[model samples]
Target: MLRILRASGLSSSFTPFRALLSSSSSPDPQRGLSVVFFGTDDFSLPVLNALVEARDCDGSVASIEVVVPKLKDPSAKCTIESVARSAGLRVHVPNRRTTLKYWGLPGAPPPGGSDGDGDDDGEPMEIGPRYDVGVVASFGYLIRPHIASAFRLGIINVHPSDLPRHRGPAPLHHTILAGDTTTAVCLIDVDPTAFDVGALLARSPLDLTTLPDTPFPPPLPVLSSTLAGTGGKLVRSALRSWNATLDAAVDQDRLGAEPSHAPKVSKDDAIVPWATAPAAHVLRLHRAFAGSFDAQAFVTLPARRKPDGARKRVKLLELDVVAAGDPAAGDAAQLAPGTIAFDKPRKRLLVGTADAVGVAVGSLQVEGKAPCSAVDFANAYLRRLLGSGFVV
Candidate 1:
């Protein structure tokens, strides 16, 4: 079962049932291409659905099939299998027998069938009668060179970031952290070894016009879903002519671009050392990780009534950045950075930062508690402080 919980108060309204039109007007799939798609995450759903829709409408694909979702957790819900099966596409799970009972479909590929067949002997086997190409989007596993070579046209990937930049698992997070105003999606030739080092087949730029210079930008999920939609279109376009697209592929190595890496984000990297970091930087971290599981920013605070100085971690979900005021103004200088204060009239909780910036908590959650508005947080934990001059 998939456990659904709000980490950063962001949720995806995207569903795979809906299909967006491709950029190319009236894409003709009569190019005699059969696609074997590999993907796992929700980011891959749109691309999968788009191809299925194209195959249903035009002859864009002679046949469309999918690999069993590369599940991160064996027991977790598989988005790729769920979506592919729902679209009535053939799903192949490596080393596992396929049956109608497996996917709850009446007429799916049977076990030991050619579709789920593998080239374990290092010998390249024909993918299938109509299967000539492969499409991968956000697939968790790397395709082996032998498996990649089996497809007549090889594989193409829909990457969310611009080629040679922000290449890795956390591209969306890194893009927001760097305050990039523009990011793009690219369809590239899969190299099967390096990350996003593939030759480019097509590219589409996404304007992040909503990212604020100081405040939190859009959540990572929203940006990822948007890019996924754009990537789906680009994938569809590439299907129109794989041979021509591959022939026109541009080598990223020749571009002489110094690429920034976005390795997977870790728990330690998500914790905000509020006392040492600038408020602007902290805000960026909050925004960048807003939608990431286990990565929202948190600050350690002393318990209100515990004289023993027992500390509690309060997770920040949403916040606003306020320009730093002169510390010399009033008693502002007397408060230490990370000190909590309340604004009664505005009903906001403000945390002091080293750089004199004030971060007004828009939403927060106590550890092991549901997220609530800042006003609610103050009411629950700082009610007495609210009466005593708004100090916490």
Candidate 2:
């Protein structure tokens, strides 16, 4: 395994792929070619590991460099850079103003002139033969066209969706929100023209709507499987396949390609609206955006009495919607959408909505308590002065 990986021309900034490079005692396969990898998120780890593994497994890879960004979140506390360092790969954090320039000096005869090592008093420094190919995923920077054409091979990217669709910034969240049943791990040509156009080497679809009643998805991972594991595996396949055929290109269907964009979900996106939204719709929104967006919904509490007999608002999170009163058929009052209904003894919250939904609250996290259940939540908090009905 190590021998094959060492020579497979493998490279990427993804970190989890370290699992692939777990073998040793072999000639280093990544010996001669210049390969660069960059990413910041853990999501990129698998591909990064797979690239290293491919070099060992196939014995075709050359030199590899890894790049990771500095994280702003104090809670982030960790990154793929440590993984790259552990693997003994060349790694750098890029800061254009301070780190490496575009490897170019402005107002020169373009780069690639002659060696500064040769005492080039008259000529500019020629960039040493650079990167045969480059791979990028979730690195959070834009690649210019001039840089795109500079690679001896080309830049291959790991985009989280199928080509021509969900192009630009967000793919995963957009796919789930659009309720797309199928998505892919696409290997794309990273060029100035646009992403998803350089020619597709591999495509694998993600099954989101296919969830099952069981806690664990058993066996031959079918429709209804949670996508995390499957998506990672599919991405690995696409990267490996694309590596095997470096020069091939496939013109994709330009017609079905409608650009739907998802900017990174913000704290505002997580403000679960108790008005105008039923629990089911709100639930989906939370799940889709939760990991990246902190799956949460906001609701103003029903009028509560103070010692002075006044009202205050309480926001909620970590909630679930159960079948309201056992899914009856036309046997309920038509509360205004976003109105609150109750099962006080059960500590249940039933929120009505424009969609004609009455969702039973599952779990909840208040401003103070660790995230807990609605029953536990209300028993301790909401049940007091929480009217049996809504002000609306």
Candidate 3:
């Protein structure tokens, strides 16, 4: 059965199996559930903050603790540890990855005690506390079976995509690249064996209609923040009615067809494929990687006067499709794909694509140089190569 709750232009829905409730044990209503949350980055913040808020206002959450990976840099900004500490929540850092396999729960004795003593390999002999449940969001590490079993109700994950589809690390990026019109946040049981192949506790669809004037398919950071906030709300609702939602959870195989994967984005995805890609595709790439720190779309320009025909990589900092009937678009239509030409009247740098319409580059960064406007780039680099047969 599915129940819908709407707020702030977003809809939260639950898919629960009535039959499972009879067999499952429910949390005590008086004290609520003791939750240990696992998360790491910016995407994890909303959910973490939501849990903290819920713990304070209602009895649904009795106490909350956070678990984060040991940061390579302790002073890094915007991390889960900092946020958790600010909220006055107890934070746990495993000595190493393997330590979690036998680590104790919050309220358990410190390591080296009878309840927390581990083997020489850092594998604890006796894990303790056994919290009511564990919540994971954007926590990349897999929870081992022993650690998962330590929680009475097991662990639940707040994933950004609907399970059984886009089931990997980079769902938001892939969703924009595919131009998906609809997307949702899923609350699922954490399958110990794999990622995102879990039972659904709740699913919430983001209302794209709310963003009528925003860029089509919305930029990556926009979509991510929207979904993360929605996921946090859904989680709060689920925890408040923990028993009912958990019992209603259904397997991914029952929810949809064959799974489609959203693989991790790499630097290669940033390399513009001008030879065969249309201008619309370039626009999609720009949107997909807009806020990405490492993988912004770029074009390779052949050296202007190099004897060995070397090429320089220029990162496309900002891009847009040329409007229809624009004179620059008409002029760019005459050039071959990958050809680069400056639009003097508009002060724009246009690049030819597989389609007749071209992509206009608003800002770009030449190799080893600071980012500059299209006019500056044209003056500094395109002057000699404009009519000299140098194509991007």
Number of the top lDDT candidate: 3
Candidate 3 overall lDDT versus native: 0.71
Give the clash count for each candidate: 2, 36, 2
Arranged by lDDT with the best first, the candidates are 3, 1, 2
Winning candidate number (TM-score): 3
lDDT for 75 (candidate 2): 39
Assess each prediction's global lDDT (C-alpha) against the native.
0.62, 0.50, 0.71
Model 1 misplacement above 4 A: 1-31, 70-75, 94-130, 210-216, 294-311, 323-335, 383-392
Give TM-scores for every candidate, taking all chains together and pairing residue i with residue i: 0.74, 0.68, 0.83
* Tens digits of per-residue lDDT for model 2, 1-392: 00001111122321111122232312223453456776666656776776676567653455667766545653342467888888898776543422222333222233234321233333123332256556776666654333333445556677776666766566666665565666766666564444444455555665544545521111112221233333345434544443344434454554356555446556566555655665566665555555454445433344445333433323444445545555521222365555555555556666665566555556656544476766775566554444433322
Q: Compose the digit string of candidate 1's lDDT tens values, residues 174-231.
A: 8877877788988876664456676777889877875444234556777888899999
Which is superior by TM-score, 1 or 2? 1
Against the true structure, candidate 2 reaches a TM-score of 0.68
Model 2, residue 252: distance off in Å is 4.1
Report how far off residue 385 is in candidate 3 (Å).
5.4
Instruction: Write model 3 residue lDDT over 156-179, tens digit each, in one string.
Output: 888888667788888888888887
